[model samples]
Target: MSFKITDNTKVYIAGCGGMLGESVYQTFTDTKCTVKATDINLTAPWLSYADVSDYSEISKDIKSFAPDLIINLAALTDLEYCEKNQEQTWLYNALGPENIGLIANELDVPVVYISTAGIVDGKQDVYNDFDEVNPLSIYAKAKYHGEVFTQNHVRKFFVFRAGWMMGGGPGKDKKFVNKIYKQLKSGQKELFVVDDKLGTPTYTKSFAKGILEVVQSGLYGVYNQVCNGDCSRFDVAKEFVRLLGLEKDVKVTKVDSDYFKAEYFAPRPFSEKLVNLKLNARGLNVMPDWQEALEDYSKVFIEDLA
Candidate 1:
């Protein structure tokens, strides 16, 4: 399981407008690899506009790029939105991956599909790559289907499951960390955070780096790529406030899940933490701790607040 990417090797990344896609692009840039970034909403000059749901478009792109690897990062991750729009969610999250897998399989290229910890049953204390997935939400179910299709259709594929992703994106990121940062920066002094749900907070950059390691190793299977430790939403908010030096004035308050039930009515796994035993056993490095990654992210966005 060892493949080398020289300067001449072409790499294609789907859904390049998202935070993870941005980080993946940066990682590839650092490695000096030939990369083509694509997304349906290609606002940036670096991305090519294409809809993955259209098999013709996907096939055309794969044939034209002739990439050594195709990384599918496109997914509909909004839990509530997906709950309400089940058809759209399934089309984008599940069907898109299946299309990409088919195209990559035809081209004889390895495909790397990004899945989520949400696919796992949160009732479990901890989940590994071998754990049976029992998705609780539409978004999770769609992503789980994508994982299954990728594994079945693509002979060479790596499915990476991540949790509570955090990183920089123009308008693609709307996760817990970004929402809290927005609230704190908009002159909000008080913050109410859920303390019940628990999972690892993954930094997109570290997750991207881990993906590169896996690709280089040429291992074709599922892996959990997330930060080293687990914590609640309240813990993440507290750490964010601390990093911004606003802990004292921010007035962070911990609340039960029922308090925000109205806003987040979608079903969520109470615990989506994933164990990195497989990655560690294979000698691949796990991501940094959430606290450490948050500090780095804070340096970029917190400065704007002041």
Candidate 2:
């Protein structure tokens, strides 16, 4: 029994103001699904107000919409900020899911929870869908806690773990791609990139599309959803510079994680590379290769550059 997201389907999305949420909102609305997207930061007109950490407020909004599905895209993702604010991190990353799960359970509807590849400790070269997750940082611990809660408590749920998310372009991309681009855009001739940290680059467009496709199958379980391949921070930076046609102008220098240790002091895995084994085996994987996705994604930044 698959849960189909038809034209009549109503989706209640929380934290719908981030990079991934932008794509997810577009994807779902394109399908003619009734989407009630909410977030604390109402950047777009289509979005309303709702804080995922606030149980009563978020519950009121979802219940009012009476959505057939609930998608929680909310999380305190800043590693350093999370390290400094453990209480807030736990509230949003952990308890938030529990709140949504309880509501979904009451509504007897399916729920979608977006998770992170950073939950793993980076001990291995790559992680599969069922790999042992040893969360290293406050962010990872809180996120992993949410993942576990959804798996154990939620009756009907789809937990998709995304890797190094790249989307939302210049305005919304808070991840690696935007950070590198900002440096390049600032007329910096030399770019210092880390060669140690490695992960699959999950494009938000592909990831959102993957979510829609996976949910349609009605397969309710946790899946390691990432791009086709993996690379280090250095690989991503070099590639982005080339894509922006700045290879000649900008020099990408490879450095170890120690280079940014003072700034990014949070504990991060050496490898957050996730293999979409489950999604592939189930024939539900729709993620493009990291390079291909990056090339397409570069157009946004290129346009911004011009």
Candidate 3:
């Protein structure tokens, strides 16, 4: 790494409660850095209430801290919620970064914005850092706008696009893996998982550590920051059942997108397979293979199955 992230460094984490934020908070705090954590809902004593959608309030709060670096992980992540609330969605996903970018530009603070692999068209078999973005959903477009605003305003910016994140255990996990785990844990004999959609399942801790390295290495650019390999939702479900020794009881039946059409109406990219090409090229990639990471994650976060 060209630069060192020492304890003396002051970092302002805009969001810090969910699986990803919790993991990022722990990883950075392990470095003994002065991390000021904030969130829309103050989940912990260290986490102050800071609404990302409100530019004035959030900017003023961040300025009081006078951080050397700013990492904005705040966003309206619910795809359907974003689709229904377009204005609020834009405000949180795009305008929030624009606001933070403005603050960073003023204070000369470098900023890191967490984006998603969902911003692609899913037409390709796999997406790399260099692939052209074709955002298919409101959430994707808004996040892409965040990336653009950050690039336009911040002198040093790092946008890391993550894939199907699998961390936050129990109450914090709001994604696919945890959802299936919950269903099976409730004595559901059959679990219908999407087989057509393919993507990497990113472990939050791995992503946090990997992205931290890139940040410390002083590499400032857009990068695909998912786990090393790809799998379908059906594959992930099978792995979950296998890990919990419920394979015998739980039947993971493969289903297509149409199965979820009645409830999950938000338009999703057909596929979200992302490769860490840029990180690999720079020799700074530390993301583990998806299967290895999954095993590690299941040890701590069995989705309330225990």
Candidate 4:
């Protein structure tokens, strides 16, 4: 049965303070659902403390809420950090979902787990929803474990694997777009971006909306919920600069991954590009094209510059 997200519906969201969390929070809140959003950071007034790694802490909080739905958005996304802190990464990215899966089983409610495109090694040009994942890094391995855990333990679960995420604007965007904008803001005339990397740009707002739609449909399973198309990192940066009307002011230089091997020491796939095969087959893909999403998202950064 499809669980409707009405005003009275109660949702317990863990790790609701990141770039993606901001959009998820707003999207659900706008629907007037009763939400208990939590994060250790407490970046927003709507967010409270919840360490997802500690099952005891999060289980207590979630059980108290007695939510009809559980969305585990918590993840340690930094590749380098995850590589260095293997144990912590496992706790957050792997065991965290295990905790949520346990609680969801207890409550018998649906759960939403966000996975990543980074899980696949770049041997394939593009990945579908059912591709065999060869996780290359500690972060990817941990996230893949979480995905598998959710599938195995939870009866009704939506594991949405996102691509290169782009949302939350300047204040919250911690991914590629924000990184490029920060360099531009810092008065860098030329931006060196790696063209070797390839992936879909998943807009947070669109992804959040897709989650709501899919969950409401009650078609519960793993889905590749990324934007309609894909591109390389250099393609994204060049388009982003053009969107900001800074094509003349700033120059985007294309380079390979080796250019910043020391800084980005963590193992990354040559291509993280994902195709929304399942979502499209189901007729639930609501994500805009990469360029369209980028243009709309750039307005926030442009305003910040003013």
Per-residue CA lDDT of candidate 4, range 82-194, in tens?
Answer: 99999999999999999999989998999999999999999989999999999999999999999999999898899999999999899988888999999999999999999
Give one digit per residue, the lDDT tens place, for model 2 in 237-282: 9999999999999888989989899999999999999999999999
Steric collisions counted per model: 1, 0, 0, 0
Estimate TM-scores for all models: 0.97, 0.99, 0.97, 0.99
User: Of models 1 and 2, which has the larger TM-score?
Assistant: 2
Off by over 4 Å in 2: none
User: RMSD of model 2, in Å?
Assistant: 0.6
TM-score head-to-head 3 vs 4, winner: 4
| lDDT value, candidate 3, whole model | 0.87
Model 2: lDDT of residue 226: 92
**Candidate 3 segments exceeding 4 Å error:** 302-304
**Where's the lowest-lDDT run of ten residues in candidate 3?**
297-306
**Candidate 1: stretches off by over 4 Å:** 169-172
Candidate 3 lDDT, tens digit per residue, 111-163? 88999999898898999988898899999999999998887768888899999
lDDT tens string, model 1, 9-56?
889999888878888999987888899999987757899887787889
